[model samples]
Target chain A: MVDVNMTLEMVQASQVGMKAIGAGIAVGLTGIGAGVAEMAIGSAAVGATAENKDVFGLVLLLTVIPETIVIFGLVVGLLLLF
Target chain B: MLKPEQMSRLLIVASKDQMAPVVTELYRHNLFHIEDYVEAGAEGYEGFKIGSPLPGATEASGDLVKIRAIENAFSIRSEDFEVKQRRKQSGLQVLIEHELPAIEQEVEGLTVNRSKLETKLKEYEQKIAELTPFTGIPGDLDLYRGYSRLVVFAGYVEKEVSLSVPHEMFFSKGKGRHFTVVIAAVEQRSVVEGALQEAGYQAVPIPDESGVPQERISFYSSQITLIKKEIEDINQKLDAIKEKHADFLVACEEILKVQVDQTEAPLRFATTNETFVAEGWVPTNRVDAVSDSLTNVTGGKIFITVLPIDLEHDVVPVEYDNPSFAKPTQMLMDVYSRPKYAELDPTLILSIMFPLFFGLILGDVGYGLLLLGMCLVLRKYLKVDDGAQLLTVLRNASFSSILFGLLYSEFLGFELPWKPIMFSRHLKIGGGEAGGQGPAIPELMMLAIWIGILHITLGRILGMINHARQDHGDHRIKAVMANFGWLAVMWGLLIVIWTIAALPLMPDLTSLPKIFINLNAAAIVGAVLLVTGVILIARDSALEIVELPTIISHVLSYARIVAVGLSSVAIAMVVNFIAIGMLISPQLEHITVVGVLFIIMGVVVFLIGHALNMALGILGGGLHSIRLHYVEFFTKFYKGGGKKYSPFGYKRRFTED
Candidate 1:
């Protein structure tokens, strides 16, 4: 009793929903990924600090580059929302 | 290929007493000056030295002279041979007499030339400063900031004028018109008044304290050309002088080298203790010769002993100790020195596995090939020390990726018109093929599992051999039983299971019945053998209960390979689905902006998603690889952490020279 022509529309709609969820998950997980990445950079920063106190800016810049992943995910989520 | 193993014992001695005599002897041979001193109330005296040789002191004549001094001063006389510390004083005297005047003359000449060049440069700069106002307005005005005061000179007429403003400021009212303002600064009043009079403005010059406003960077224009000319002249003079005196400088350097050598050599010999007592590190292979040399020098009075030290895990609490950071640093050190011991020699296993997993998670043949090509080109042109080794491993993995690409039937996640050389037998690619027309997915999975099994088996075998070698008889029994006995039991069980499965599926096949019967008998025999092996192994251990769990855990750790491989494939599939779905969507208008956007989005998603997947895969795969080596493989044969041999030498940063 299923309408064959309407199946394609149903599938597309489901895809849109799935994509929205995927975007959210991607954004949420990106924060976790950023934290994971910062663990290594933070350790390296501590190591650098042993040698020089003036490297805080450089370390902060490097550590933030990875955080761009979360920003990218956020941008995608915003697009989905709109 | 045979794996390289570390030597059992390190030849380097760490004791301070043991190190002193060797250092003293090397110093004596190299003609290094040593100083000995005693604190007023201390029971023991201390000696120190500038031990390393100066540059260009390794010539035959210099070495011969130092050797002769050592033989005459220290070898012949067992009595205390205190260095005649007055040699430095005598050397200084000689320097003043023979070389000081020439050096002073050269320095004076250089100073005179520099002064003359500086004066000429200043004159040229002044001329350029005067000419700066004549040049047309230079470059864009947006680059400059701060208050700009214009003193416009209009000759013969006063008129309403409009000035062109930047296009960005077109919205502002009255910004295009030139406006007149009264000046306040006293220094600028005369200049403003003169300009206004020249321009035929209303003839009133205001005498005020505030100067006329002008452009901030106006002074720099005139000096630019003259400054350049002066710099060029000075450079030319310097070039001429450098060319003329190049050989003279070389000769002076040689003379200094000889003088330092002569002075330091005799002092080196005289300072060394007559009855030498010293200890220091030597390469493991050179330990015998070092010990023999010590015996010859001190007539067997020196005691020499070598101890094994682990370089990998042993943390020396020196000035740079930070426990949190040390773990990764030690891992890096292990990677740097004797890298093969971590996995395979050259870490080929890690190298191959990482990129393969990366490419798998990436799942785009085009990108994979691009990366492969880039890595290859870098490996070829760059002068990296590890380039060749890393390239060989990557080249192999790239080939593996190409193979996997064929199997996945993906080229940048696009289906090909031609038949794929390899294809997944489980999931029909593009839903075209139904039955088995390609390589079986289960077969590939089985191959991966088999490889994992082989690797773990190798680890166990190594562990057994190392135990046997380290402890002769009964102590090795457990290792042997844990490896071989378990393998035998597992194989026996598998044979029986295979037979049972085959009996119903292939009743007509005579081979199945024979295999089934034989395997069933083998399983019973294998069980008895396993029990006997375990009992023998358990005999030496105090607590059988503890050893059982350890053995079981080690065996089970082999499952990580399958887990990692499955994760790689799953991630790849997801990326492929997203990429293909974007490209093939019918809603996007073909050949239009929407269509182009879809294509671009697809490409971006493919690249970004796969790249992330690759990075994650590498982390997981690399850690798992290292774990397999450290816990499973090295637990068998390796007792790392040996001290590396470091000789007294110059530290080269850029090049060997």
Candidate 2:
């Protein structure tokens, strides 16, 4: 097996930063995607919940389901760096 | 039980002699939800018209309408003043006999007087403006009005135009603010008008009055003062009437309403001169008690029959009977839908599962306490009635969150000092605290997938039970197979994923050949079950293929359960990092002016940052869990188009039976 110090020296600091950068982009873009999906769903959800209080829980659920996109991105991001 | 309470139709027949006693007894029992029987298609009975209202209903309705009008005229608000404790029959009789007629007359007089005063006040105000401009005129307005030949243009003009107009025209200085002037008939009247137009002349329309401008000014000024006093007097009278009758007017309207409803009760039945018949629905479990009570009340003279027959096509009212602890979960189902009479009620399952997911996302003790405290404050101190359902959901969610908080050993993104009831969140996976390590991201993803597996399986199980409940003959094999197939395919997918993710664990899997073979076997198992479930659900069409991608996405959706919690913790940790940075800032090395400024800024940042994090935590944690139920969980088993139960009985306020 190669020495741990030698292996660490072989990897460039900039290349390590690049992985971190990729993870950030993955998370950031997913955030924008989640926000867009929430905007469209949220408007209808709010209107329905206003008409009847009963629809509030369902509306809240529908409004946040798109959040999974960001979580997927977070997983991808975490995998990249860690 | 995960189903609405069972119900059956009821019919009661009472002779004219027993109708009063029967109606009274039914009112006391509060059992029937009356179905108004209109003889729309009774072929033999064209003479059987809908039942008419009992005696005095007309009078009661008239009194009610009058009370309403008085209340409106007086602008009476029920909550404006304290009302009498309860509205008794005697109280209503006294109000109708003594107070209503007097209140009606007084309100009428006050309204007429107020309107007259209002009109006079407007007239006086208009005259005051008109006469003020004319007061400076040398001659009376009447003197100007009598002119037959004079080209009288009397109005204000701009400063520039007043100078340029013909000198022979009446040049007396009027109100200088606008340079008011009267252009009498000049020799060149046309040319003069052209000059006036160029000068921006605004002609004042003269009112037909008998007196001079100065006299009229004084006359209007005095008139306005008198009218102001009169209007004030009218206002005072109306206010006094309101003060005296505000409470009484509110009570009077309520009494008349109850009287009207009681008198109009017979209109729901089919009545002949000799007999009355009415139909309604009652909960099956309470039918024996209701029947017994009605018989005893009417001395068994009137027949009360419980019809046990079931009509599958008829729309039946649905009544939910959830235990008190599970009532909040019913609020979630109510917003989505009311279950059909024959389908399952998902509230109890929802109660257990919804908060579990919520608490999983929260996973922080400090924020849980904050949320719980906020809900308690809102529910107890605020006493707001609207959105009580939402508040109940928040309270339940926070309770679960506190439970999870202890398990995760997190206190506002900080690790607890003592032993946790379970593992810490920091040990789970991914970034959370400022300086903490965790298991691989893949591990968390797997946990999310497992949760999805269980949630979806439970949904299918419930769906299977719902179908079985509605089935009459031997269990409908196709429906059962479809539900059973869903369960099989989900498990198949779960095992396949678990097997692949754990492939490296097979003791130095330098043997790539064995890994490939294991994956192949798992894939085959998943594929065969998937196809079987598809065939069961969609035997006639290729449309079933569309659900495969949906199934995959639905499982992935559970990833949010982990994702939202991670973000919430990240935000909290970030806030703490910033706050601590300020407290121990490098700028604080010499205690300079800038250092003190930075400390203050940091304190503000810390408070605002944590406050924002806590708010988002509640929304993200509470809502995402609820989403798992409605979107991922409920579609599996629930069919919701049940008619809501609204009994034909008044909810009395300020009255009791």
Candidate 3:
């Protein structure tokens, strides 16, 4: 019975470890995802700027929407670390 | 190839005498105007207007004299003298004719001003180009340094004194063996060579061969840049002036609109009532709202009517009213509607089946969840119209995917640690047990077949209802007989087949004479009733001989459900095989990095490929499902030959006609 309890605890620990690893992976990939997302928006914003300078605010707002996903992932990772 | 058949009920009220008042009223309504008039007959009894107001005109009438007043109180004049009479009494002809030349002259003057403005814009662009050195440096740099042995870097020059000193000095250290200098820049070369020889004693003279000119090529690039800035400032001033001119352009357009309205009003009154009556076509569903608006506008003076537009008949009858719904009810209705006749709606069976199939093909809870989330996000925020509509459809699909995901017991291509919902508990089973222990193939197959049967039965029921509503006595009878009687027969056949197959294994049940007697009696009764129903249905139709073939084909259409379900399962199997094979490879085991990469790639490929396949399959299957309803089911009972409604109003396409 003691052995069973030890094995169960070990499995639980391993599960937590696996979850931690997944969290790290999610955070590490998020930067690359954000960069890719911003590349298209940045180029589009530059093009729009050439036509009308007033579009800068709007372009900036739209470009930042995708970055929030990465930030959320980071927050989750940080919470897990603590 | 159907020609539009003209309605025989129309009547024209515009005689030569009536044309004057009609034209005046039309102009008063600001519906149309006449621009230019030409006499057609010797008596000037017939004439054509060159320019008329386009359709969709809406404005208050101008202060032109009434044509009706002139006709009512005018002296007798020769046909040729009609213009003089019109000018003398009505004065409207004079006002209309006078306004034309003045507006034209104003427009011509504005055109000239616009050209001048355009030229000023071009001049400003040239000035801006000249002001910036960043734009001019690259082109000029090549011209100044081409083939010159003397190198200049940040105002420092390196000049060659002798040809015999080997061309290595021109290039940076270590790269000299690859580079050979063909030209040298030198001033008083013999003196420089003597000094060099005194220092090293190996210097020799060769002809001065540098391509660079002796005098510096000076140009006022900076001055040009300043001038360009000044021009840009001038352009800003010009832009302000042009904005003011735009108001004048708007005013001129308004004047032109008035003039065109005056010209065409007479023609519109004379022609539209006779040629094409006042009519507007709107979406069938929006008819009530449009009619209410029309009634409110005219204070119930104008008549509002409806007609269902039949594509097959090419006829729009005068009395068919459509039901109001924001979305089309049937999957087929979306495609068959007036605006989207070319696109086929995939909402029918495909709507439900596609997501189910996709869930089966994908069989991964994690991927399904991802797809659902993505679809939801796109639907909520994206400005794309079709994509948003598709997301709404995918919402329904996601539910089916979730259901399938649970059944497959997969989460991101891995079996979940927790027990699956379908099985009560985990069985100690392998693939060899009953061929594959996950799900019984016979059970799944039976489910697919049953689904097909139910779908076909529903379609037949709908057909019978539609036919009954039409009140076509014989046709209604036929629809009922074929739909219900055949279903009964099919059920009886299934029972007999099942009993016969099971009898050998159950001797006690088989030996009972009562079971056989009941089965034979039921089968005979069902067969007789079905044959009678078919004969009854065929009694009134000309192609009664072909009724059996038609009925059989209709029944066979339901088989698609089973076929589509099986294909979904097959696709899932293939995806699983590829993912599992890649994961378990011996070489891949040692190469952890490659193995991880392969797993990720496999998961990604599986997710995308299966999802796309599911989406497309759903669309195709949905369309086929709707087709089954429209052709097989609806044909059994419905006769949709109703006409659409149209009312008199400003057309949508032209703002001012």
Which candidate has the highest TM-score of all?
2
Which runs in model 1 stand beyond 4 Å of their true positions?
A: A1-82, B1-272, B275-368, B377-396, B403-441, B472-483, B489-519, B542-563, B584-590, B620-627, B636-639, B650-657
lDDT of 1 by residue, B1-657 (tens): 223333223222222333344543443333111222222332322453323332344553453443333333223221222222223334444544455455445545654665776776675555444333322223232322233553322112243423232111111112332223332244465655654455344422222112221232344344555556665765565556445433333333334434454334333321233332222334445557656665565555565676555444432211111233122223322442332232223233434444454334334465458557866787756554455545544555556566666656655445445554543422333343221243344444444434545655665566565555545455456656655654544444444444445432222222333334354444455456656545554554435434454443444344444445445545654666666554635435557777777778877877787777665654565455545555554544445433333233322121111
RMSD of each: 15.5, 5.6, 19.6
For candidate 1, give the docking quality class from DockQ: incorrect
Candidate 3: count the clashes. Answer: 23
Better of 2 and 3 by lDDT: 2
- What TM-score would each prediction reach against the true structure? 0.44, 0.81, 0.43
Cα error, candidate 1, residue B16 (Å): 18
Worst 10 residues of 3 chain B by lDDT: B77-86
Error of 3 at B363 (Å): 7.0
Worst 10 residues of 1 chain B by lDDT: B165-174
Tell me, per candidate, how large a share of the native contacts it keeps.
Answer: 0.00, 0.40, 0.00
Q: A17-80, model 2: which lDDT tens digit per residue?
A: 7899999999999999999999999999989988987666567767877877876787688668
Provide per-model DockQ scores.
0.06, 0.33, 0.02
